[model samples]
Target: MRNQILGRQGEQVAVEFLQRQGYGICARNFRVPVGEIDIIARKGDVLAFVEVKTRHGNRYGTPAQAVNFHKQKKIIQTAQWFLRQKCLSEDKCFCRFDVVEVYALPEGKWQVHHLPGAFEC
Candidate 1:
């Protein structure tokens, strides 16, 4: 339960960071039958589906490293479902996947890094 709270808090921070960077937030925690998208935003004509990973330290690995090929496939499937449900044509708008890494610091603040167009579907 504590971890869930921290995760949600981290996601909120990611959303705010994206907004500040001129990305229009389209959705948060967008759920489909396949999986959930942490944050969805638009920059110009491109729709960005972002996966946010937060960790206390790099003892295991970097946050972005957690998103492996299998995970990327799941995200892409979910994004497809989202677009279909919204009646949006894939060709009408550009789509890209992004990953946001958040590190929880000792001072109780977070360091956010946004990797735009991080991966391809």
Candidate 2:
């Protein structure tokens, strides 16, 4: 439960950070049978399928490290489905996988690390 809350808060921070970076948010929590995408954003002709990872500290590892091979595969599959559903040609509209790491800090502040093209589809 606590983790979920932290994750939600982190996602929000990621959204704000992405907006600042000029990425227009397209969707949030896009879920399908295969997998789920935390956030989807668009910039120019690029569609970014984002996975958000949040942590209080880096004791285990950086939040982005959590997205391993299996997770990447699932996100890729879901991104494919999303493109088909949206009737967007993958050839014309470029697609990218991004990971946004949000670290909760002291004094009610947070830090965001946006990794664009973090993975390939």
Candidate 3:
């Protein structure tokens, strides 16, 4: 439960960060039997499938570090599922994967880091 709460909070922060940067949000928490994509946004012709990671400190490692190769594979598969659902082919649509790292600071504020085109799908 605690992890879910923190993850949801982190996703909200990520959404705000993207919006502030002028990305229009298309979906949140898009899920399938295989995995879930945290956020989907568009900036002009490029569509983004975002993965959000949040942490209080670097006790384990950086937020991006948590998204291991296995996780990346799952996200990629899910992204493919999403595009197919939208009837959009990879060749026709401009799409990319992004990672948003939300640091939960001691002061309760957050630091959001956006990594555009973090990986290929």
User: Which candidate number would show the highest lDDT if scored against the true structure?
Assistant: 2
Alpha-carbon RMSD to native, per candidate: 0.9, 0.7, 0.9
Model 3, residue 4: C-alpha shift (Å) = 1.3
- How far residue 17's Cα lies from its native spot in candidate 2, in Å, is 0.8
Model 2, 1-121: lDDT tens digits are: 9999999999999999999989999999999999999999999989999999999999999988999999999999999888889988789888999999999999989999889999885
TM-score of 3: 0.95
Worst 10 residues of 1 by lDDT: 1-10
What is candidate 1's lDDT per residue for 40-115, written digit by digit as tens? 8998999999999988988999999999999999999999998998999789999999999998898788999999
Top TM-score model: 2
**lDDT score, residue 65, model 2?**
92
Worst 10 residues of 3 by lDDT: 103-112
Per-model CA lDDT versus the true structure? 0.92, 0.94, 0.92
Candidate 1, clashing residue pairs? none
For TM-score, candidate 1 versus 2, the one ahead is 2
| Between candidates 2 and 3, the lDDT winner | 2
TM per candidate: 0.96, 0.97, 0.95
In order of listing, the candidates' clash counts read 0, 0, 0
Candidate 3 C-alpha lDDT tens digits along 1-121: 9988999999999999999999999999999988999999999989999999999978898898888899999999998999989998889879999999999887679999999988875
